[model samples]
Each structure stands twice: as structure tokens, then as C-alpha cells.
Target: MRELFGEVIHTYTRAQALADGSLIDVTETAAEAGFRLPVAVTRTVWLRYCEWPEELGTGQSTEGRLWDVLWLAVWAARTAAEPSARITYTLGVVPVDDPEGDPVDVRLWAAITGEGAGGAPVVTIGAPEDW
Candidate 1:
């Protein structure tokens, strides 16, 4: 798991925090960004993911979680033909200096995608067992 996500975690710690992620009407720009985002996003959802160290002496799983949302001007436009179309974003995470003056360790991410087959968006994450 670290082999797949190690670089992402490493770069996240150095990423700039506090970004503006307002919605953008991207019908005219999806193809340009190499983004096949949908023309119209039916809804947007907010999610928070947390991870706690399980070692014997680790503490504050609830309080130690540190994270930052990226500056994402993300928007989904129509598929140019299909109305049931959709979009997705790999919303990146960033570490911020917490009240303890420590750099946050990101164990998960905030993901984005069109509503699932269940008619609602999916949210939250759990660490991989192998990590």
C-alpha cells in the first residue's frame, strides 16, 4: 500500500494549504483539462476522513487528525450527449500545522464522484489493512 500511496503522502505534507475550491461552470473547459467531467453535476457532497494510530501509546485519534482541502476549481459539465452523464475528482489532501505545531499526517482522502447506483454519493475512508 505504501508503494502505491507513499509519494502522494510525502508530497501532501509539503503542499500549500488553504485553497479556494469554488464551483466552476466547466462545460467549455473539461476537454481542455483532460477532464471528462459531466456537463451538469446534480449534487455535491462534503466528507471528512480520520485515522488514529493504533500503537499502544498512540493517543488522540479524534484530536490528532490533521488535514487540508486543496484549491480545486472543479466542475462537471454534460458529456456532450448523455444526460445521465457524470464526473469525478481525485480531491487531494494537504497537511497543516495543527495546534500542537506538528505537521498533519494524512491517512486518507476526500473523494468525489457522481451519485452511486444507490442514488447517493459515497464518502469516508478506512486505511488499507496492508498499510
Candidate 2:
């Protein structure tokens, strides 16, 4: 249970980081790898990495970048991408707090396979009013 909770926190943190450009530079990184569109965020971030012979280096796997992978996952959230689809992040139970500094602002992010098979990345941005 604790492990799951920890993962949730990581998701929320990563999402905000990507959104704010404070995390790994997804745009520049992808561009350096020769991606035409590079990276973008439309309700969610989108990124695709490749380390082919012509780009980066030969036979190198452009993988393991956390934010990059998360962006791809979010892009794949569409039902059409189900062949390799996934749910990376989402706004969970946004409990209306008094707009303070400790409210419950839930944001879930995970590789959802089916119903109830999601992760919670709560991004609490206000006060906890629902005590």
C-alpha cells in the first residue's frame, strides 16, 4: 500500500514539473533526437523518443526518460491508441477546499489497464477544508 501511495505522489510531481518546464526538458531533448513535432501538452503532454543510427547515436535506445515516457502514455490515453494505450495522469477527486494552501486536489496518473486499475497523483494546491 505504501508503495502504491509513493507512486501516486511521483506522478503528481512529474505532471506539474512537465507542465511547468521545470522537469527534464522534453521539448529540447526530443528535438535533439530529431523529432519533428518535438514535445507538446494538450490537456496532457506528448513526446516520442528515438535513438537511431542517424540521431543521437547508433543502436542506442532512447528510452527510460521518465517525463518522456509519461508524455507518450498521456498521448496514448486515447481509445484508438489502446493497442499500446495507457493512463499516465488525471485530475482525481478535486475536493473543494477553501482555496487555501492545504486543500485536497487529487490528480491521478498511472498505466491503467481497466476500471479501478488506476493510480492517484493528488496535486493538492489549496487548504484542506473538508476536515
Candidate 3:
């Protein structure tokens, strides 16, 4: 493919994204939620769902929110009929600024990469549009 496409001009890798803050590594938290593979979340999802700023004065913790996301992903993956490259799931999240408000349903996607490419599979979770 590279030969047909000629010399590569540029490439942006997942590692670069992680280092640059475009992708937040949540592998540790994901593992605790029963995931064995590496996991990450796009910055948008991080800010929208996982992040719980102190100024919000809410009881919600970032770790708890992140766990909810990953735990739901794990459950979805396990229940899927067949293993695929992408898995979509939805979860309810109470807004940080409005903790008393009804939970909003957010659809998220988890994509698996590096399968037959010889590297271990990694999971990236993001908003539906992020895919």
C-alpha cells in the first residue's frame, strides 16, 4: 500500500496522540473494570463524561465516572454476539453542574485496534461522532 501510495508524507500515531493529550490513557482504570487490553478515551469524552472538576462541588468522582464507562464497555463486549472491530454502548451520566437532574443518555463507541497486525489489541472509547 505504501508503495502504491508513494512515499509517506506524514503520520500521527496513537502514542503521539496519548503524549499530546489528544487521547487520555485509562488502561489502569479499565483494568480494574475487568479489561485486560490497553484502553483510552478521546479528549472530548474525557471532558464531557469522565472529568469531574472540583469547582463543581459534586459528589461524583472522576474515577467513578471513568469506571462506569469502562465497566459498561466490558459488559457490552462480553455480551456481543461476535467479536468485531467496534462496539457501541450507551450509558447514563448525571451532569456535573446538575447532579440532581435526570441522567442523560450518551452513546459511546469502543474500537479495537492492532488485532491481526501483530500488536496487542487496544480499546479506544469515544463519543459516537468521534468514530
Clash tally, candidates in order: 5, 8, 0
Model 3 poorest 10 in a row by lDDT: 114-123
The lDDT of each candidate is 0.28, 0.33, 0.87
> Which sections of candidate 1 miss by over 4 Å?
1-49, 56-58, 62-101, 105-111, 124-131
- Across 1-131, the per-residue lDDT of candidate 1 in tens digits comes to 77876644443110121123222123333334343432211112122322233442334342233221111222322232333222232333322223234343333222334323344443222222211
- Judge candidate 1 at residue 13 and give its lDDT: 13
TM-score of each: 0.21, 0.20, 0.88
Q: Over the stretch 77-104, how does candidate 2's per-residue lDDT look in tens digits? A: 4434344322433332212222123323
Q: Give me the displacement of residue 12 in model 1, in angstroms.
A: 26
Predicted structure with the largest TM-score when compared to the true one = 3
Runs in model 3 lying further than 4 Å from the true structure: 97-100, 115-118
Top-down lDDT ranking? 3, 2, 1
- Residue 123 CA displacement from its true place in model 1, Å: 3.6
